[model samples]
Target chain A: MNVLIVLAHPERKSFNGGLVDVAVKQLEDAGHQVEVGDLYAEQFDPVEHAEQYPHSAVASDYFYPLNEQRAHYQQDTLPQDVQRELARLEWADLVIFQFPLWWHAQPAILKGWFDRVLVYGGRYTSRMRYDHGYFRGKRAMLSVTAGSPGIAFQPFGRAGDMVAWLWPMHASLYYVGFDVLPPQVSYGVQGGGIEYQKEDALRIHLNACKECWATRLAHWEREKPIPFAGWEDWNSEGVLCETSPWRWRLG
Target chain B: MNVLIVLAHPERKSFNGGLVDVAVKQLEDAGHQVEVGDLYAEQFDPVEHAEQYPHSAVASDYFYPLNEQRAHYQQDTLPQDVQRELARLEWADLVIFQFPLWWHAQPAILKGWFDRVLVYGGRYTSRMRYDHGYFRGKRAMLSVTAGSPGIAFQPFGRAGDMVAWLWPMHASLYYVGFDVLPPQVSYGVQGGGIEYQKEDALRIHLNACKECWATRLAHWEREKPIPFAGWEDWNSEGVLCETSPWRWRLG
Candidate 1:
């Protein structure tokens, strides 16, 4: 098995980095080849614009990211960084996104990964999305840390539902044909100032979080992907069919 | 009304740019003071790391972004760019985020805006968030454009729910006590290569979308904010009460 851990945290010494380290060790010990995409360390350009398309631009005047993505991808003239990331994705059987939740989502760098790496006409199209996506057999999961406690992320909590916050990411992964696994959330990650808790307690918590991540990765292959209603569940107008169980639950 | 439109698109001549222009003209025509934060034009550095805090470092060994943000904010030594943005936010009565939805959310530049500008301790703290955030009285709204059509973003649509995509952003704004208005999404925005539609038809569609946006801004003051559950709605554990209406609806 091949595992790609995309680490999006700034500081490599941060807890998020620690999680990636844990994953690499655990996955390697399990006889898997591990490749880590340390976004910050590589200085991954997060902004997707015309500048990325130095060659093979479909329209020179107006920059549509999707068109540029498709053109460059076909021409094999995509930016070196993007080509490298795509190569990594192509090599990986499973991908893990390790990052601290900033403003209830992944950091800009990781967000731009999806924007740039996931080429529209290549990775997905109108008909080639959802279950029929390009990377159908691959699996992906998010390993996120939040500054707020677990309780605050519960439904109707002050921090809002973690499930809801992760839905967009989960959906995107699913759209690209990856079997999306449930997220591993390290809640109440005392980020900068450890004023709230004792040093010993914080250390214990951090270690425990790392252990939990390691344990999860040990059995990742056996875990079931989160259920998402696919094309068959929806009607012609792209809404959930009246008879669909999701309509009753989600509507 | 003092309105700050933070434009996040790369190309200044793109549709997203036109939307900003339309917004400024409309808001100004309605006797509102408008400020456009063209992130790309200004070359705003979106990456927040140790480099952002050159002098104000609580701990030089580890880079904790929140701690640096709080420390720099208190010392009045925040990076010049951050300081300028904070000043704009402070001056604005209503904040408008203008961007193209790249990967089910705002562009990386805009995402970084939320990460950098919204100071952790200064803009929001555990106690001073939600209804009591630092920018309590200010109103913030998202004016987004999507390449997909409206039908594709319905509740069970192929594009996924627009509401879910915007939830993280909406919750983030609401967390900082901004009254988040319903997003103005111009769907089916035929981006760079408009081979599917004729030039005249594309022009008409673009103009209509601009007019719709302009019309909405004309009544900005009278617009009611989208309702979100408040602190009072949750229990000590931060979960919604069993008897709460949300529990019945969401659960």
Candidate 2:
């Protein structure tokens, strides 16, 4: 299998960069061909532009019919680097995004990469049937480091459970047709004392990547439906159930 | 109150653009000052280079302090557009973002603005106490238009609910100390064949904005905690009873 690693942080010396390095090596060690998208080093523009749309071809199956709503595709121009990254995405079987959690999310460069490269007719939708859109059967995983303790991502905790924090990305990837995998998270990136205490965290994360690579086919075969809280059920059917942590029984 | 509208969509004729028009008129009618960021026109850069970090700040703040992470305070390399945005943020009383929902979230340009402009010292933690960080008490809202209907955002349904979809943005804003009003979402923007229906929907949204503006001061006076889902309760503790649609039971 061919893999793509999209690294977003600018500081090569940063732990996130190290994460990318290890993941790439591990993927190669597992005999998978790996491609690197070092977004910042490549100077990728996260900003979107109009020209990226492939309007000429109305190819029915693999493409989206977005000619009617092309106006929404317009955005400020993206730098050349982003276009290159998109080209890379077109050539991979698995996409691994490695970045530090900035403001509880991906860095601007990474976000921008998604913005610019995943155009209306590209990643989100295409001439294909709406239900069978872009990124179908493609795989994506987020490899990240956070300053807070991983425990904070749990229910009844301060921040949120890491899974819930990543729910949107998970759902979006699923919605857009990707066979999403569980995230590889390294918490306490900032002063967690883990950096000194566990010099092998990177190796561990890489091993996780190898496990992911080894089990890619089986993982897809046993794909788990993403979980949802009660609020989602209530909001949909207007069901007011008491004693549920997620939904409220308004008077 | 002076407000800034950072228009991110490229098309001046898109529905998102029209929403911006409505937002400006409403804010002005309420006697608040408004300015347009017009990001697409100005071409703001969301990526921050290492050179953009403030010169005099200690390395601890640059690398470790969560509050100081996003600010690009260095006078020399700081772009003029970013300076202008920071100035507007400093000058305005409210900030309203208008954009077409791209892949279930804001466009990359807008997200990038938050990434580049909302710095650690400026939007998160600053020289002031942790509680009094920059953007403390600043009010913000997201007015978005989606191609899908409101029904699609259901719990047991295929996609995420509209409110839950905005979780990351809301959490980021709240974590950085901004007060986020409930997002005003326009569902089924692409739903065909009824101009009058679209107008009616727009009217209701405009009214919501008007109400928000009228009660902006009062709304600020209270703390509105965002509600979460209760699946964890069933998973961890146990399923409770039912109440109203929005209300949930503990234990």
Candidate 3:
């Protein structure tokens, strides 16, 4: 199996950094060819600009369905690093997004990655479907670290569960084609001795990534789709039904 | 009664443009001073950078609670236009965000505004507990336009309604202390070909803006808060709490 890790974080010594290392090791030990896109280390520019898609390039004709953003897909040159990351995404069987949660979502750089690399024709709507552009069938997972305690994330608590909080990321990824899996989250990341926490978090991340890969590999060979327990039955299109906090709370 | 309009759409002929014009006109008619920060027109860069806050100029030293983003925040110079817009936000009694809905949420530029302007020590997380951050007493309202038919956005439709879809936006804005009002969404924006529909939509927007201003004015004068049946109560926390089908449906 070929796996790609899209890692975002400024500090290589951070727990997120350890998680990245653990994920790489686990996939490699499992006999998969693993590649890492150390976004910050590579200084991957998250900002999508006109330069990202060069008109000189034959493939530049791809169009995103939305009208407001066509200029970005056409105008500027994509930074070299971002282009390279896109290539990795194109080659991967499994894509892993590793980062710390910021403002209850991905950091600007990671968000920028989506803003740019997931082009209209490539990842979402295209000129073929003037009204309905989408992403169809890939697999992805998130590995995140939150500073708050785990219990603080319930509906009755301060912030909701990290999984529930990440609806936008999941929906956006799944809406296009990625089979969105549940994420691995490390809570109480602000304390517990920085060095020890980093190691523990890394180990936990490794186990989560391995489990995710095993499940995907299982489904890859199976006739049935991998089932999601939390969501309702898949819709007619095979996408999971949309559910929200109230539903979760009521249930 | 000073109002600031932060318009995100780039196209002047767009219905979003018309809404902007109407909002400005209505605010002015109510005798409030209005400032328009037509983001795209002014070329406001939403990217945050080191230049945005010089050590000498920064009021709050903290970028993140843990202080990890200082370097990233200061990397690029805060673009002049965004700086000017932030200044305007500081000067206004109310801020109106006007944009077309993209993928069931804010356009990237508007999202970028939150990414940049709502700085750690500046717009958010003031050292003083109760008096935290700038833009405290200031109000905010989202003026959004949707492309689908209005009926397609109801609870029974594929995607839920627009109100529930806006929870995060309302939550984030409220957490930061904006006395948020329920957002104003013009559903069925694509149905503008129907004369009465367009007229009715425009009227709804016009009246809503007028009422919003009146509410703010009344609140400032220590009078009762403004009320509109269904509109204001749609989302009790000044955000629409209901769901829309467009959010869940693929089409």
Best by DockQ: 1
lDDT of 1 by residue, A1-251 (tens): 99999999888888888888889999999999999999999999988878788764787767778788878778888899988999999999999999999998999888888888898778888889889888899999999999778888877676888998888889899988999989999987876423333688787787888899999889999999998888898788777888888876653
Q: How many backbone clashes does candidate 1 have?
A: 0
TM (B chain), model 2: 0.68
RMSD of each: 2.2, 8.2, 9.1
Better of 2 and 3 by TM-score: 2
Residue A229 lDDT in candidate 3:
29
lDDT of 2 by residue, B1-251 (tens): 77877787765555566667667776677677779888877877777655455452435322432323433453233456667788898887667777777655677777778777766544554233223446766777776767765665544334456765677777676666566777667665652223223478755654454455444433432546444333332222222224333223331
Task: Give the candidate number with the greatest TM-score.
Answer: 1
Residue lDDT tens for model 2, A32-107: 7888878777777666544444342332222122442233334423334544665777788788888877655677
Cα lDDT of model 3 by residue, B1-251, tens digit: 88888887645545666676666776677788988887666656554433344442332422222332333235434445555666787788778788766545566566657766665544555232122424557677877777654554554333445654565566556556666676777765642223224467665654564455445444433432222122222232323234622223221
Per-residue lDDT value at A164 in model 1: 86
Off by over 4 Å in 1: A192-198, B193-199, B241-245
Minimal lDDT window, size 10, model 3 chain A: A126-135
lDDT of 2 at B123: 54
CAPRI-style quality class for the chain A–B interface of candidate 1: medium
- Among these predictions, the greatest lDDT belongs to 1
